[model samples]
Target: MQARHFKETYSELLSLTDSVPERVWTGILIAGCLALPWVVGSYSLSFATLSLVMIVGVLGLNLLTGVCGLISLGHAGFMAVGAYGAGIAAADYGLSILPSMLIGGLIAAASSLLVGIPSLRLKGLYLAITTLAFTVISTHVILNTPEITRGSTGLFLPEPNFFGYELNTPQKYYLFCLATCVLFVLATLNIMRSRVGRAFIAIREQDIAAEMMGINLRRYKLLAFAISAFYTGVSGALFAYHIRYINVDTFGLTLSIEALGMIIVGGLGSIAGAIIGAIFMTLLPEAVRMFFELFATQLNGLFATRALELRGLIYGAIIILILRFQPEGLIKIWRECRRIWGNWPFRY
Candidate 1:
């Protein structure tokens, strides 16, 4: 009786998910995203902006790791190319924010192509090692290349504006970031459902088999890097403008690994996962740090000493726990709940 009941419930869950049209699901997501800023507090909304920046990065990482089956241990370098590129354009040339962002993204993409072309021929660990080397080299190049990057001192950027209005306030910047995140996520979702997405998945599942099935390995591989870098670069560029400044130290291996971790924790090959993961990772650190500081007086030495170390310890512990269970990530849990609720009237 128990086995029969479990099978019936599982069948009902599957049936409900399939019942909802894709268009409807997309509409609901769009509406929810649009409503976030209005519904959340200002501080929370600002963190949402930070998540927005992270979201763009994770989406790109997803393309490389989730779809293309390639790993980039040094994507932070690409992001640096983009951030500095955009920062330079606005600071030096007096270009508008949008144009500066475009130039920055272009610079990152071009650099990525240079790295991808020769290095992509290698697979798995070899590819990762090559990118990691590029990352280390990129950091030194930016720090020492004074003619362009300006060394340890960070560069300040002009406030972003459209015509008359400058996006100078936290609220205004949040709105801008929110809109961009939505558009990019939509674009990502659309891509994964299209022809290029199919090619990417083919490469991911089995590159040799994909090549045998008429997919050009080199062409698609480079294309993935180009696309991924452009997204990360543009976001990096946007991040420079949004934050009001940038520096060589801003782009580091820690950020590169965190970007990868966001996708991993969020769930690979899932757009919803990318978003949820970014939000989780972005907010968790902030919340923990703030909580410790806010209660330091009341908690005394118990919470005050070595708080930063505690934050890292907690984060590492959570990662291990998440991997042990809920390996598909937080989004999968949300979807499961939705499925059960959506079919409550007739649970088999």
Candidate 2:
């Protein structure tokens, strides 16, 4: 009876919007997001738009690698598929940005099956290699297929429009990206509380145990890949629209690694972690560059060149420190802070 009561209490704690303070904070954040475009300049708005797109992409990856224990190093390739898919539709079919992006997501989802099926039999590092190979091959295909993907020359896309309104300016497009990010993040949170989410957690912890409990390993694993691909693909489509150009080189292996780093630094299997990581990783490099520009005179000119070269090394050091000290990521730190505040006036 005590165990049953404990389980119920624990479940209540896991409720998505249970706490009044949390709900209040969420509302405030939403209001701020809605008002941000009016106050921010174009460059900041553009940066925020890119951050939102990355947040969506990272959430999808968290579902796969974080929740389902699927290791993939080919995420950028999937994004490329999405970008090209939407670009082709918008260019060739005269479709609007909204519908074309959806089509791009669908195309990427379908393509994921090709990799998912073969790699299902493999686990861990082997599976990672399979996905890596897929990314490499996908890039080559994009580069060689000049007829379809425009090859090395790249494809230019018109500014995205919706309901007859053009979203050419960064401020206008910020709203579009913001809406999509909010919707997708909410969807991902709901999904993490559902039966499918439970199954994913099970698989991640112990696949054999999950199979014994009647979970279909094959189906769910592929589903993870497909859904992750869909999210990434949509981000790619948005990227194409945002950049107004598409090239095979844009979504490279480095981009895939960055996505992985987001999940790692944010927290595996955590939706909040994905968002936090995406924001941090996205802004960190830009902040560094800006700092260099601002301090170019105070620091030697040689420092600027070295800073650019050492960015990767600094990024690596940060990740290592996080993993070494707080492997659970920023979400854990955030939770700890919340817990401490909640326990104020009482020493545990």
Candidate 3:
């Protein structure tokens, strides 16, 4: 095979090269997802839905920490706000799912201002600690406010009703989540391609140089927080509805850490990385469970009580190994494979 290039015109030059394969693969993937619910068991369908929801949240965090170079430990706190916001709107106000989700996202974005504004002057460990404090404070508030949030008892959400249809089944909810995930993924890609997205990358590379280039650090930073929070909030809303029950502990520090890990493992600042990372992390626990199950008879139930602990240990080890050997993340590995395939039969 010989490599060919066609660039006779400016438009042709600007257009995507070798796009047909990409389109074909994307179409196949989409079709598979659409047909997945009918083919898979209920548990698998539910797992897929959870993966999609996490993808939404991870994409938001990627925009903030990965693209904008903002460090946040309060992602779960923002998610809690969104969850409670949507939960309250639907449970109490009797609003529909769409409106409730919108309100939740808006509320989360507004709350992000409290942290975002202060973050303009903070960086690195200091910024991380600040966000951590915010998470602690948010958790405290949620716990104390029993009347609204239902506190430690948990809040029960009504069945998600979109228009006249009720998303009562796992398959229905999964489809809803899949649609939402696609929209957010597309939105993130567009944002990264736009002027604001360029500014975000510039700030991430070198704030001082970006400022010298007339980029407004404070404005873009704050905007990043707002947008990130909105994405997370909607994700929270979906979560609340998905489970139909949420407590403060549901959106705890563990979730924030997992979101951060997803971005790191997937490849920071890459949209596809976020999606891939979310899917991988979501399925990791199940993989661990399957491993234990496979050796259940041989282990003689020795690891039954310690499964959770072992899972965490294995998870940490895998992350360390990936960081040690492939610091660029799983996306780098993906790119390398693609490059090799594209250059098959010849090494340049």
Candidate 4:
């Protein structure tokens, strides 16, 4: 069957309407996700919840690096700000879950100004290095401020309360994360479809051309940073609650690199790419561990001793392979499959 578009007018052609298949697929996915916790065990549910949190953070990076062409290496620093901010609010201030998360996100957005303003003049590698420096400074500050963040000792978070109900169970937390992830996804989609999103894309393609076309580079770039930071901050807050523990060491440079890899391997500038990439990367380590466990007798404890190194090696290799063969990322493969299915039985 060959799918055909028979729009009679330009408006119809340009409308962002979902085809029947797309709508049906989306509905099925939603149903499956909603039913996942009941079918899966606690460990699997925990993994899915973590994946959702990463999706939020990765989506933020996609907006900045993918859509706006601004490379950042201090994303984890912003996450730290959010996590600490939310942790302080919930733990020390006695605020509920929702308010603490919002406060954390807002504080992260404000802190982004420190780098966003500098981004007005910086580009490419310079901007990335500048962000990296911010991350270093952020960790130092968090570690030094023993009174506030408890320094290297770490901060403990209480169970999140939603409308007086304590989200103590893994299933409840998973549902909360899913709902939050869906909201952020919708927000990102809306942003990408709006004038701001167009401006970001224009800047990404050519800043000078965008400037000539009357786009305010200063405003949009800063806005991008703020929005991206907010998303990441909320993600950090979720992470803090998910684990109920956090320290400066938690938001390390490696975590930032991992987030960057998620966007790159998922497909830059695509929402579906962010989601797919997060899930794939999140599951990769677990898959490796499973393989090691399956071959424990043959390996004779070698994997147990050098698990981290082996995992990193395999992860880097897979990323390199993906870059070599599918530079456009996994989303490209998905689209190709969908296209093939749509055009099945029509050789021409």
lDDT of each: 0.82, 0.89, 0.90, 0.92
Clashing pairs in 2: none
Off by over 4 Å in 1: 1-42, 290-299, 345-348
**Model 1, TM vs. native:** 0.88
Q: TM-scores of all models?
A: 0.88, 0.94, 0.95, 0.95
List, residue by residue over 292-346, the lDDT tens digit for candidate 3: 8888889857787787888789888888998889888899999998888888767
lDDT tens per residue, model 4, 48-119: 999999999999999999999999998899999999999999989888889999999999999999999977
Error of 3 at 303 (Å): 1.6
Scored by TM-score, the top model is: 4
The TM-score of candidate 4 is 0.95
Q: What is the C-alpha RMSD of each candidate to the true structure, in Å?
A: 5.5, 2.9, 2.1, 1.9
* Model 2, span 21-91: residue lDDT tens: 78899999999988999988888888888999999889989999999999998799899999999999999
Model 4 CA lDDT for position 309:
91
Task: Report the lDDT tens digits of candidate 1 across residue range 236-271.
Answer: 987887678788778888998888888888888888
User: How much is 344 displaced in model 4, in angstroms?
Assistant: 0.8
**Clash totals, every prediction:** 0, 0, 0, 0
